[model samples]
Target: MDSKRYIQLLKKFDGLDADTEGENTRSSVSYAILSNSETNQLQKCLGARLFEQGFQPKLIKTEFNNFATDSLDTEGELFQSDLDFVFFVLSPMGLKETIPSELNERSQFASSFLSELEMFVKNFSNKGVKVFLANIPETSERVFGNMSRIYPASFLYQIQAINAGINNLVAKSQGLYLVDLASKANYYGLSEWHDNGLWLQGKYPCHPRFFPTICDEVSAIFSSLVGKIQKCLVLDLDNTLWGGVAGDDGIDGVKIGDGIVGEAHVQFQKYVLDLKNRGVVLTIASKNYEDVAIDIIENHPRMILRKNDFAVIKANWEDKASNIQEIAAELNIGLDSLVFLDDNPFERGIVRDHLPQVCVPELPEDPTEFVDFLTQLNLFETTQFSDEDLSRSEFYYSESERKSLQKNAVDLKNYLSMLNMEACVKPIDEKSLPRSVQLSQRSNQFNLRTQRIDEMTCEKYIKEPDKFCFTVDLTDKYGALGIISCVFMSLKKDHLYIDEFIMSCRVLKRTVESLIFNEILNIAKENKAKFVVGEYIRTKKNKLVENLYQDYGFENTERSDEGSLWRIEVSGFSDLDTSIKVKRS
Candidate 1:
């Protein structure tokens, strides 16, 4: 969508009535914009972009200089609003007003400024709200000119110090993110990003023409926070990965790895290899003979990604959409996680029309620009990375091997026993907290009552007396699957309520569910509870686990349009016999 159309839609939404606005909002996300300058134009641009990305954005803009105190209501009590994200949009001039211009007095002012910012971030993060701190941009007007470069306490030096300090804080903090506004301004050129005439009259830091670029960055950050990050990249074989069709032109005739045109595809493949190394799954969904494609992939010396690199290869004469669905099912991920890349415009259009969830970027007319175009899209922006992420492709390969073993076993019990599985259940601590939060954010298919949370909330559950939060790490004879399941339960006087239950889809049929259910019963029994309650919250991707409570002997208590409530008496709980070993810590 164009910038003018986006502005028009924002005006239409701004004029909507309360009831009509509430009715149109889907997948509701509450956010706040705290800025010292006029932010109505930026907020409108952000809302339009977020809405285009399928989020129903509900935003509140605080008055200038009210960042700390605006969270409270008019009665001087804490407000009941549940905010998902908060953006602190700070301009260098706004912060300069509070700090002294004298070189000798600047150190004390910097200390106090950082302290106040840290306190504000901590206050909101304790409530599970993600905070985005925009780095202060440099002043367009150089007051000291060349002297500012040498002086330690100059305005430019102070701003750079603050940005460095913010980066350090974000590195240590769990839920705080840094927006590099200075680098973005430098890229777009200061002359185009800032207008001195408009800034002097209206106090607008950024020019109106660059609102679209600013909002695109904001939209990318918002998408990453809400688990909209893409996981897999599905590629086509002929003309997409090489210079020509392999089947028609023959393997030796296909241009690759020598000339300028072939070097473009080579560079593209090298870029894709980098993505795979960072943990994005590489896949192939081509419409060629399976054996013919595999033979070329195995023998081609210039190929950056070989046969072993792909998690799933659907190289048959099938429709592209169906091939993508098969890949999703095989990988046990949502369709939204896949990004389809094809050189043919017709193929791209077919996938876009049939499966709207998949992200399909428009390839430029020149193949030489493909790498630059994909890099600019930033479709796989992630805030956190772990050791498990680096080894994710290996984990999927292990899962495929496990499935083959399951098919050959005599029965369910024999299959599980032969695998030799061991589960370690432990309370959430410093070492296990990162993976636990990741599982909460990523798991979808086997999740019952999906409750997304941040690291602070997971830590709170671990420290609270009446709450029980634990993670399960499983290892078999094949390999170690790190932190596959998580459970959060709240203990009441008469009953234990299960707040969240989620497990990785790779370990679904190995009786891990039964083991976790038994552990929950044990906790309830130890607390002398009368009943244990569970819920099945329906979602677009969680239908696989809708009947989970029923399968676990939890009697249905009430049914609603939203979800079903279930309860099982402690006395009625019985243990199931399993061959896997369990250790509690």
Candidate 2:
């Protein structure tokens, strides 16, 4: 493939490219390579590709060292610099002799190396750097083995074991990615690269042709890691969800009974279940009755998903785009997280135009292709799966229930009182710091300002006398809602500047805002400040918070080309009576 074709393929693969634009702008990402060679042809190819696309490519030379010397410290020095990715080249290294035994019996050197690598990744991830592990060329295997025929039997096994170790390390490291170079090359086979075989090809060990291909693969993997994956998969009911439409042919007539189509849906549901297992939230935005959809999913012999499978279901009579946004609000997730799936082109087009970030998968004519299509479109891939993934669907499902409770109430004030809620506020310590920063970066609606703060920045803010950051954990008689909200404020002059005020949409209309206002006013009063000020910065998905200041009686005192600002007098601002008991940490 040409450079353009390579880029297109990378986009198709949803790989990383820092200068991603046009149709593949969503896939833009940055990457760096870790290598033992500084001037290899593969590195040149990588640099060229990145340069053409206006992306800065990083390359690290992996020089061998005698552990008896200060190689570890030197490696540490190299790692302290800015790096997002590393490809440990195993070729030049004499792996056959080196792999089976540790440099020391305790394996201290290797452990230290891996541990340092892990620390680097964690620190970088906290700074928003994504790292990937790349497999060294397989051609190096024979070369290394030829040089160590005495250990011929253990040669391949040794390299495999080292690769496995790297894989394990990558899996354990947060924000670390892996590129299966060996597997990909093996799939296409040696014949594809060489006239005789991969070994005979002119490109064999540092092969010029293989370098470009491998570089492309590495670049593609990096692209995929840089951006946020789509969160929710909004599925249709008919052939998309199940096998047939229940409205046309009745519940029994639906193809999701005990047939081939039925099996396809069964597998499809299992796939969706796997996504949920990994925290990719599922929601149904179908044009069918809620009861009917639930019945099919619950009672059907072929069904694998149940009523609780969906985080938010919009089975009511509504436009797909409208329903999708509603789902986003209910789950407290962004519209960008939504990936709308429909069998009909019209519905897909509607969502595509109305909700552009809501990824609308191309409608395939056949149902069997559904799995393959989605597999290729790995919109749900994450760098790591957290404990939260297992219960995310239930969390959003409970969020929907909370919304239902709010809807029946007379007003926001009454709704908050009726819930008999309590807030558990806490300073973000070591245990809660990651989750707090993650929420700060990810939370969309109800967010006053969308500042993507890092963990270090959060720590610094928490220590500042002028600033305050607190997370609110809310729970009522309904269920335990974990870390439902957060607020960041600072004292400035005669006012308490509300820098960040965001609550989980699950806690919406529950007087969380009023409670926050009261807390801020109390802080202002205690600090001897005369006024409380706040800003409403606009993001496409956070329009819900634009009028938030008005709800809390904060009048617009300043308006500029940048954004709107509001302030409430500490003396005059009345603390809205809230039933939710507040506890400060």
Candidate 3:
């Protein structure tokens, strides 16, 4: 968001004085901030952000300047409460120290700083809490001036050493992420970010003036961890993607290249294409004739994206708000998962009115400002990314092909047989850890129990010999959908328990579920187990799978306000028949 909007929102947050009663009691998520500095305003701003996202913000904080005692003591209130995540804010000002004498002394300082960080993070992570940390911001003392690059006793050089070690430590530690506060400080300029007078007087994390920006940054990281990130980009034509109207100026007359004004649009196109490369599905929802807009996409020399690059295209004279709805439905994604970019104020305002869940950034009139404005929102942040993410756009193309074939087929069974599907099931090894954890966070609609596991807990499952953690990748005549489903199970005596089972919505009616169910029965029978158990945890979006166990002939043994439980004897179980071929790894 822009600076002006940040101030406006903070003002709105300041007016919530009467609604501040359950600030300490745990809600949906209990978040604790253990900072070495004063965190009164930081807690307020982060709570405001979470409240805006439809989540109950249970803010937990430590006493001022006593973060160490709260973090290190396991029996303290910080750990005693049901805390889900934590942020460890550190700064050099909090830890008083003397400057090193020479360049060789920098390594010693870095080692000590990293050791302290490791201790704090490991303390929380050992108890199954996710940790978010920030490196100390860099500031120059001006002792060596520009010669700090080679100077023997430069604070900047020492800061660089400490930051380097922070990266290595976070990488080695599972469920730990290093959020760079220095980068944000550099963006807003050091003068606005650092206030020496306020630091000495009240011990604020940064200048109180810049609290809005930093708190927004930290809250966005938590948002992505809960699988609330946008997945698609919906674009508009005319002044939004080019300099002039396509109908009024014609394709040859439209200014997209060979001119000074056209270069700005070209730069914006490159930024959008880069988002596509990183697995953001690109789609167009413009108010134009289909043939004319596609001609430009097909023949324009400066266009960075082509017609095939998009997963769906809705170019017609219909209202942009309805077009956005159609795009979401066609892709089988949530309306909140789309980021719509339109240059016209009228179109943006209309969509915002109709779909409050959709993210509509206020694009400046100047095309040059488009990239920077969108980059600052951080709309597509993610907790985990994998090689499957890089090729996810192809899955949409495969979906399109399947839709066309289904339209011509005689019936659902014929469509399934025509595709000739195949499913490859494998145990979750170290190589599949990243994608498996990502699916755990992303899938909801088809999840059996919707258990979100982190990499560290999953690694423990891999090493425990008795637990079964596996993944399934599907392919057909059309194309491949990599790692689309997963099953995590364990055994207790004679019964095998299915803790979590999740599948992508794209494979909803493809009989992939039947193949997986057959595989689970096989695993239980091979282990000489007497019964197979399954669970159904009720959530807002998981109603699709509430009757899944019943359809498979598992008897419902238990039901409650929480969820339902089912069990089937192995002697009575029969293999579920499916058209898809199966292979094991």
Per-candidate Cα lDDT values, in order, are 0.80, 0.64, 0.81
lDDT by residue for model 1 over 160-230, one digit each (tens)? 77788898989899888877788778877777766667767776767766666666777787776666778
Question: Which candidate ranks first by TM-score, i.e. highest?
Answer: 3
Clashing residue pairs, candidate 2? 15-223, 15-224, 16-222, 16-223, 16-224, 17-29, 34-87, 203-207
TM-score of 2: 0.71
lDDT of 3 by residue, 455-512 (tens): 8878877887668888998888877788889888898899889989988888888888
Ranking by TM-score: 3, 1, 2
Better of 2 and 3 by TM-score: 3
Per-candidate clash tally? 0, 8, 0
Q: How much is the lDDT of residue 514 in candidate 3? A: 89
Q: Best lDDT goes to which candidate?
A: 3
Candidate 2 — worst ten consecutive residues by lDDT sum?
A: 62-71
lDDT of 2 by residue, 1-585 (tens): 234544443343334334344532222223344433332445456655554433445444333322212123434634465555555443423333344353234223344445554554455465455655665434323534555333433344444544566689766555566766666556446444323332233323433345556665555555334323466788888888787787786678888647788778777878888888777788888888888877777787667778788877788888988998888766767786788889989899998999887778795878777887786555665543444556677777777777787779778767766777888877667666666665665666767877755555677767888887777777787666777677788888778888887676666766677777777788789899998889988755678888888877889987664468998888987779777899887
| CA displacement after TM-score superposition, residue 203 of candidate 3 (Å) | 1.8
Weakest 10 consecutive residues, lDDT, candidate 1? 71-80
